[model samples]
Target: MKKDDQTVTEATALHSFDAMLTTYERWAQPCSQTFSRAALDGAALPVGATILDVCAGMGALAVPAAELGHRGWAIDVSPGMIERAAERLKPHAGWSTEVMDALDLHFGDNEFDAAFSVLGVVYFGPETGTALEQMVRVVRPGGVISVVNWAEPLGATFFIPVSRAVDRFDDPEVGKFVAPLTEFLEGPQLERALSGAGCVDVRSESVSGHFAVPSAEIFMEELDSVFQVLPQYRAAIAKDRDRFRDILVEEVLLMASKELPPARANIAYGRVPTPQETVGSSGLATS
Candidate 1:
């Protein structure tokens, strides 16, 4: 595929997630939720408040939030994901699912008391800043916006498969990572994206996890959904698949020694600055 065509195709893969749910939820939930609730704890949002779960795959955090007595709305771009989330949350009240998107959330301004994302809000490509601003837009003043994303240049255990899969890309012209790549923000990027969006009191952490598995085969098998979404690797070699599986196995064994945390980037929690707050030259507001 041509450069533009490849990126466009990859973007489509990233957004479409029907075929990959089983694998995604199994590996993603452990850390997605662990970091999600941890980030919320850092922000200290009220338990009874209304919450928005953006990019909420299979309602991992949504179900828990509802169980906690918070009214929750879970949004995803995949109908399959929506259906799955609905099924998962059906037995519980106070939670609903929608096939809407995070970038173009349908809620009104300040419509929610708290908005949280787990393994979401990282794949905006060129439009990341705008999407994050959108997340901030839907929250009421003093409400919390928290996000947990995978850190990039992943360690050997995680990066092995990702590197091989990324290398399988047919097009060499596309320079930036198909998704988060090295965009795992820690300091200034977080400040700019959050505070720039009028969020305040941002606190973050560098948390990690080690996913135990029977074997590397078990681990690599779980990545089929993301592989399907990655257009570059969709046409990948069978040998490449083996290599990815093997690499992950080797890395897993290595990381298992230290522990196989899913290699998370950060869980950032910040509040929307009150209107009386100041907007600084860098898009940050100084109260």
Candidate 2:
């Protein structure tokens, strides 16, 4: 992506996240906490290890790592998110949050024992590889780099209603809205990205969990906040916002009434290669 495009993407993401921050913090806590634990477990960090949480929204991963006795440095593109994370992490010593871009981390080489991003980074779109490379660069050799992304099918579930609403419009431009919301990396695809970023012994697995919501009405209310931020969603409904929302609300309520399957995620992880290991693998000898 060009620098201009990347800047626009970041700005748009920050805007969406500003609107999403409250609902996400409330409705997404259970799922975020669960996935954070899974990512940390995959990293297998020693206690007191220095860890980095890239695109660490609201400190979901950082808080758990801090509780595990690891020192954590969390970074996100949104100042609002960093502020919220700082508040949550204040009680823990050696835990901090910074407003920073994932594609260009400010940390030094091998500054951390491990690094992770949970339900984050994949949204970087075309810049996902660059962000992962930054994560790999900041971790010490032999340190783990882990990330959790929503499996495509599971990721699409929440947006099914939106898709249905768009279909009612029968317009190509409106249909484009579904693509961005549902296009997520599967396990193998994610592994390729990680391996390409210099991680070795890369592996991924599906993790199943669910978001805890009390009722369909409340769920729709929280979710509507999310849709409002999507520029495509706004544009699609511009001609008939109320009609679109009505259809979407009805679809969501109906879907929620049924017994939905647990949300599944792909958690990929690998170790950074040590100098000796790298040389040995390359069949090179040191002087």
**Top TM-score: which candidate number?**
2
In Å, residue 251's CA in model 1 sits off its true spot by 6.5
* Residue 17 lDDT in candidate 1: 68
Q: Give the total clashing residue pairs for model 1.
A: 6
Candidate 1 residue lDDT tens string, 155-196: 213445455445544335422235424454564466556766
Which predicted model would earn the best lDDT?
2
Task: Give residue 169's error in model 1 in angstroms.
Answer: 14
lDDT of 1: 0.66
- Model 2 segments more than 4 A misplaced: 2-8, 153-157, 169-173, 181-184, 213-221, 229-232, 279-287
lDDT of 2 by residue, 113-137 (tens): 8999887777677878788889999
Residue 218 CA displacement from its true place in model 2, Å:
4.7
Q: After superposition, how far is residue 50 of candidate 1 from its true place, in Å?
A: 0.7
Clashing residue pairs in candidate 1 are 209-260, 209-261, 209-262, 210-260, 210-261, 211-260
